[model samples]
Target: MSTSRHLSAHIDRPVREVYEYAADPLNTPKWAAGLAGSIEQVDGQWVADSPMGRITITFAERNQYGVLDHDVTLPSGETVHNPMRVLPDGDGAEIVFTVRQRAGMTDDDFARDADAVQADLHTLKQLLER
Candidate 1:
């Protein structure tokens, strides 16, 4: 099943700054609490380490907006899909985080994941505003 989490924040900075900050892999660890580090490749793929474990994110860019298609390998050896998008919203931007889990996961599991994504958005807002 597919589950999604969407969060919006208004930053005082221009859209370019916000979009650029979000696009840079090195800056991810600053705002995304779960992300410990990220390594980017010329092919637009990024390998990130988070608390849950490691994930490979493929990027597709269109102008200043982009989508991150993620495949996460959990400590339990289960792989999950967590695709996300960052789109320009007036002066700021909106972030949409989505996850598709295989069979056997409950709604509660998706809810927990959504909550974590929301928390990460809060952190992102804080970082950009500073």
Candidate 2:
């Protein structure tokens, strides 16, 4: 029971197209600044450098239902599960990202995180539409 927000962006692309592109972790850094720099597979695990130091990123197995949920383990060993999905909306698609306010997060911190997620989703839409 925490404060949560579902930030979304509408993309002018098919659901399958959006899902395929986003389901790939390599494409993350191109749009999402949260992961920052680059993502590489180290010792069979996806690792990325972030403002919070190096972190481990794991994505849910690719599926037909457009479930793009992923788990991000911070350097301090805290794991945050991010729920994301691409759903059909008319001829295009809608990308939804759920951001939940975590423990110790102040109201300002939560708002900042939500803003970041929205910007990331907007980037995704721009990338796909072009």
Candidate 3:
């Protein structure tokens, strides 16, 4: 089993609003720094450029439960499952992302991934709040 970290950011917006905005993959690069600045739909799949080369991003079906899970297919054909959520936090919203440490990753690598997830969530918060 791998280690996991749950990173989140609180956004000054309603859960429905945040869910509507973040549910669209086209809006990803605007806040998701881990992905390239652009993404596109090709043959019904969201494709983007990544540090490891071209990749495919597949998100969970839209739902009322605020689940934003997704799977990222790497160039090597390995797919990583990412579970996320936009939860109600009083009048605001809390966006949560689960980061898991893959096999062969060191403690520093896992920490970096957690940091990146936190930063990405923060960006999402800033965008939605504005």
Candidate 4:
């Protein structure tokens, strides 16, 4: 059974700025609370490490509209479907984070992972706005 979690946040910046900030690999560690380091490429892919574990993000697409498709791998050796997007909201941007977990994982597991992602996003917002 696949499970999913969604999170949204509003940032006081333009969509482009938000997208740029999110797309930058070196900046990930600053925004991602659990990320200790990251390896990025121009092709839009990165491998990030944290105390819990390491995750890889492959950017499938990115545009000015603030939309991105990527995959995330958890420490439990589970690969998750992550489709993160951003939208323009007045002078700011609205970010949406979605997680799709693999079968056989408990809801509690998904919730815990989702909470971590949410916390990371909140840090991301703070980093960009500051």
Which candidate ranks first by TM-score, i.e. highest? 2
Q: Model 1, residue 106: displacement in angstroms?
A: 1.9
> Could you give candidate 2's per-residue lDDT for residues 14-98 as a string of tens digits?
9999999999989989999866578999999999988679999999999999999999999989999999999999999999999
Cα shift from native, residue 61, model 2 (Å): 0.1
Candidate 4 C-alpha lDDT tens digits along 1-130: 4556778889998888899888766777787665445555535547777666766766655566666666666677666566788888999998998876657757787787778878888888888888
In terms of lDDT, the best-performing candidate is 2
lDDT of 3: 0.89
Error of 1 at 99 (Å): 4.3
Order of the predicted models by TM-score, top scorer first: 2, 3, 4, 1
- Counting clashing residue pairs in each candidate, in order, gives 0, 0, 0, 0
Give the candidate order by descending lDDT.
2, 3, 4, 1
Cα-based lDDT for every prediction? 0.64, 0.92, 0.89, 0.74
Model 1 agreement with the true structure over 49-108: per-residue lDDT tens digits: 777666665444535455654555565776666666666677766666665445776888
Candidate 1 residue 40 C-alpha distance from true site, Å: 6.4
Compared with the true structure, the alpha-carbon lDDT of candidate 1 equals 0.64
Off by over 4 Å in 2: none
What candidate 4 gets wrong by more than 4 Å, as runs, is 34-36, 40-45, 73-78
Residue 56 in candidate 4, Cα distance off native in Å? 3.2
Better of 1 and 2 by lDDT: 2
Candidate 4 versus the native: TM-score?
0.79
Clashing pairs in 1: none
TM-score (all chains, Cα) for each model:
0.69, 0.97, 0.96, 0.79
